[model samples]
Target: MLYIVSALKPEAQAFVDHYKLKKSKLNNFTIFSNYNIRLIISGMGVENARLATQTLINNFDITDDDTYLNTGICGASRSYTIGELIECGGVNYNGIDHIFQENRPIISCVSEEVATPSYELADMESYGFYDAVIHNPAIKQFHIIKVVSDHFEPQKVGKEETKSLLFNVIDDINKIINF
Candidate 1:
């Protein structure tokens, strides 16, 4: 099974549309799923992501082949173009950096939305997702993939734009999840 955790409905909409997933509710979280792929909308922020991810984990029967992914839009520097896909290798939460992959970009997972590009990349939910899934022994493969939606100006990114950014990268996301 390929399980995805997205921070917003617009972010999850791309997968729901492409995969033709059916809508359902898993506790308070909104989940979209077919037979092979399941996506949960975690809302925005660290704690929400953590709780939603943990809820998904606890409710499911995880196999060794199951792949978990956190896919969403991020605030990046000008070096990254809008709609660009970034497979993050590590995430920096609070003051510490946790390495997941060896050499890709490190995303800063902040508690609140960032208006300025303080880090090379920034998002609100990666670390929370990471913190919840990392401790599970059954989850052998997990990935954090983010799309560049804004360059220090998050107010400009609309719901349609967020969905489009993720829609453009569906193929890439498929390649990563192998589904």
Candidate 2:
């Protein structure tokens, strides 16, 4: 079974609308399930993410064999044009090194071991969840998928819009699931 995790209820509902899953909640955690897929709208922030993930794992009895995904929107590099979907190969936190192009300084993904980092180019959560739950042998696959929502703009993406953007790409998400 695949366990999908998102930061908001809208994103979760988007998946539910398409899949037509059963909706249920546990201690305020919204959950939806369809066949082999389970989606959880975990709210926001790393701490909230930890709680949600742990609750899902405990309640659903998720193990290492299940696919775990952290999907959401995030800030993109200034050099990266808006509306681009970038896969997170690795996450680097803390200070980012400047990339030089045409004598102009450009910010980009930091070159560092995924094992060690402080701040990531993208991702609001999953680090804590990965760190906490990844040691189990039952976990077969873990992936981080995110779309660029803004170029560090203050604009907030409403629930409906986020649903439209994410649900439209279910094929891509399914690929990730299959992978």
Best-performing candidate as measured by TM-score: 1
What is each predicted model's overall lDDT from 0 to 1? 0.93, 0.63
The local lDDT score (0 to 100) that residue 17 gets in candidate 2 is 83
lDDT of 1 by residue, 8-92 (tens): 9999999999999999999999999999998999999999999989998999999998999999999999999999999999999
Q: Tell me how candidate 1 scores on lDDT.
A: 0.93
Cα TM-score per model: 0.98, 0.76
Per-residue accuracy of model 2 over 1-179 as CA lDDT, tens digit each: 77788887766776788889898877778888978888787776667777777776777766656887777766665655444555555543344332211332222232221222232345566454554456555566776667666555525566677777677777787785683
Q: Which regions of candidate 2 deviate over 4 angstroms?
A: 63-65, 93-120
Output the lDDT of residue 80, model 1.
98
Q: How accurate is candidate 2 locally (lDDT)?
A: 0.63
